[model samples]
Target: MDIKNKVALVTGGGTGIGRATSIALASRGAIVAVNYSRSKSEAEETVQWIRSEGGRAVAVQANVSLDREVRGMVATVVEQLGTVDLLVNNASITQHILLDDLEGATEEIWDELYGVNVKGMFFCARAVAPFMKSNKQGSIVNVGSIAGLTGAGSSLPYAVSKAAVHGLTKSLARALAPEISVSSVAPGAVATRWWEGREEQMNHLSPNLLLKRIAQPEDIAKMICAMLEQESMTGQILTVDSGQTL
Candidate 1:
């Protein structure tokens, strides 16, 4: 699957891995729709950057947790850039509750995390399926976390949500076979805004990895583009954690 001239939609395409991926896709000649829930300025900045680099892009707004909004967003992308050929389900959110603090993992916390991290991915995938099927080919890469595999993260619900995302990726792969490919990239401790206030912790954890450093957004972004461009792989979860899980 060569990415050239494909219409790519990247949810949360304002910061971190999402931003890197939008840029990467555009650099490869894909027409990009940069989706954001609230980070309007950042999304616009990303769009401007891509345009400045001689790439085509647009900043779109949608809260992916809402199925209606996801559908509307896909429609808007089609109206503006044609049917979506690639999707990067990169939008996600998390809370900082300690894993052992079951009380802190309240119903609202569970709902909020799952809404954005798990259901959001599904909604986006569902919204775009028809277009991909119409085009006869498509690719999707869900952004998962090593925490999904390890059951450890900022919060228990967040880890659980990511695990669900991995499951969704496989199911979508099986459900949308022959015409579309679905996969996941599970990254560990990426150097993104998610670690803003936890800089000291990130610094301390870096040397513990086999690669001696935590992953940068581009590292994960590169893997995502690779997953999108490959034709033979599906229902796979590729880890770009600098060997952290090892």
Candidate 2:
């Protein structure tokens, strides 16, 4: 589908992949709604950048874990930017607990991780489905992780949560096919804020990676743009892992 003048909503668009995605979509002539849970300033900055580039955009605030908030966010986007033609589920949280620290992977951590990663993506997709169906055309891209495919990440719960996202991508694609295409991008060790203090770990692991380096946020963003351009691709998880899975 042509993204020009389409309205796109990106959750957690304040930083990392989401921010890059927002910019990419805007550059493609889409009216972007940049969503953020706490990074309001960052979201605003993204909006400003898009505007500076002569694109249309707005900063939206919402927590994807809450269905009510998700609903409200969709409503605001529709009201302000028009019904969403593109939805990018990018908001997620993870803890840096070691796999050996079974004690550290408590119920609270599980809930927080799942709430934002699994349930959050579902909630946002559910909220936007109606709008997309109404238009009879749309695209949904869920930001997952290579860890989901390999069952490895900063924490076990984080990996499990992203795995659930991959499952949801398939299920949603089947459920919303021929109208709203659903797909996912699973990136490996992106150089986002999530890896701040873990630089040494990533450095140590880099040599083993086939690409011998980590992925940048723009690498994942470009793949998302490519998926959105395709009309026949759905229920597919494109892994932009720089060959880490190899």
Candidate 3:
């Protein structure tokens, strides 16, 4: 994966790690499609930044939870940028609910989280598979979370959804092997908008980690780029936590 002149699609590319990954890919000479569900302004801003930095990028709108939208998105990217050579399944959602509150983890919550966090990733991969297969080479990095491994996160359903994402990564790796490589980057607490009003909590947790600092979006973005470029690794889950899980 040279990344140079490749076409990269990053879902939820409007903010946080998605945004960072889009920029990183563009810097590496990949023409980037920044997919966003509702963050139109932010997505466009990211594209502008990339262009200003002398990189190529576009902002595509798609609600990744819908299979049709996912397919449509890939089609649009191909029409505009040729083919998708790399994909970052970074779109996800979470709800704030107590871990022990079974009632709080309602059917709606489960469905909502799984729809975007789990199934969305699968749909995107499936839609892009043919393009990658046609080229006989591609790479996918699903953005998972340490919560998936530990079953702890903003909400129970959120954690469960990420766990499913990790599983999906492995299965896709096997299914798309010999042509496409699939892997996952499970990040721990990072300084993103997800902690908008919980700065204090983030601060408290930072010192406890072995690194004694929360990871920035760029840190995870770097790991994601590394995963995309690693030719010998597939079906692997690389964690970018600043020793939070250690």
Candidate 4:
């Protein structure tokens, strides 16, 4: 899948891995649709940076948690940027509740997290399916987490939601085979704003990792680019965790 002139949509493209992925795709000559929920400014910033680097990009606002918004977003991207040839489902949410604090895991918290982290991915993928299937070729990469594979993360619900994302990756791969290649990139602890006040946690985990440092967004972004370029790979969860899970 050559990225040159390809149209790619990245959810949560305003910040962190999504932001990096957007830039990476643009760098490869893909016209990126940067989707943001509340990080409009940041998403625009990413587009500006891409433009500065002589790449093409646009920031589209949409809350993946809502089906209508997802549909509208896809419609806008198709109308403006043409069909979505690549999709990176990176939008997600997490709570700080501990695994043992089941009481803190209220229904509201569960629903909110699931709404974005799991259901949102499904909606975005489903919305873009027709466009990709009609084109007879596409690539979808769900941004999963090591927590999904290992049952460890910021919170139990967050981990569970990521697990659901991993499941969706496989199911979508099977459902949209040959024409669309579906895969996932599960990253370990990354040094993004999401870890703003979790220095101690990062410090504690670094020495144990094979790389002895946390992953940067670009590290994961490079892996995602590689995944998008693979023509024969599908239904695979490529973990870019610096061997932390080992």
Q: Provide the global lDDT of candidate 1 against the true structure.
A: 0.96
Q: Candidates' TM-scores?
A: 0.99, 0.98, 0.99, 0.98
Better structure of 1 and 3 per lDDT:
1
Task: Summarize candidate 4's per-residue lDDT along 1-246 as a digit string, tens digits.
Answer: 998999999999979999999999998899999999999899999999999999999999999999999999999999999889999999998988889999999999999999999999999999999999999899999999999999988999999999999999999999999899999999999989988788888889889999898999999999999999899999999899989899
Query: Against the true structure, candidate 2 has what lDDT?
Result: 0.92
lDDT per residue as tens, model 1, 117-165: 9999999999999999999999999999999999999999999999999
Give the alpha carbon lDDT tens digit for every residue of 4-76 in model 2: 9999999999799999999999999999999999999999999999999999999988889999999999999
* True-structure lDDT of candidate 3: 0.95
What TM-score, to 2 decimals, does candidate 4 have? 0.98
The candidate, 1 or 4, that scores higher on lDDT is: 1
Clash pairs (backbone) in predicted model 4: none
Candidate 2, poorest ten consecutive residues by summed lDDT: 197-206
Runs of candidate 4 exceeding 4 Å displacement: none
- Local accuracy of candidate 3 as per-residue lDDT tens digits, 56-171: 99999999999999999999999999999999999999998989999988888888899999999999999999999999999999999999999999999999899999999999
lDDT of 3 at 59: 96
lDDT of each: 0.96, 0.92, 0.95, 0.94
| Candidate number with greatest lDDT | 1
Off by over 4 Å in 3: none
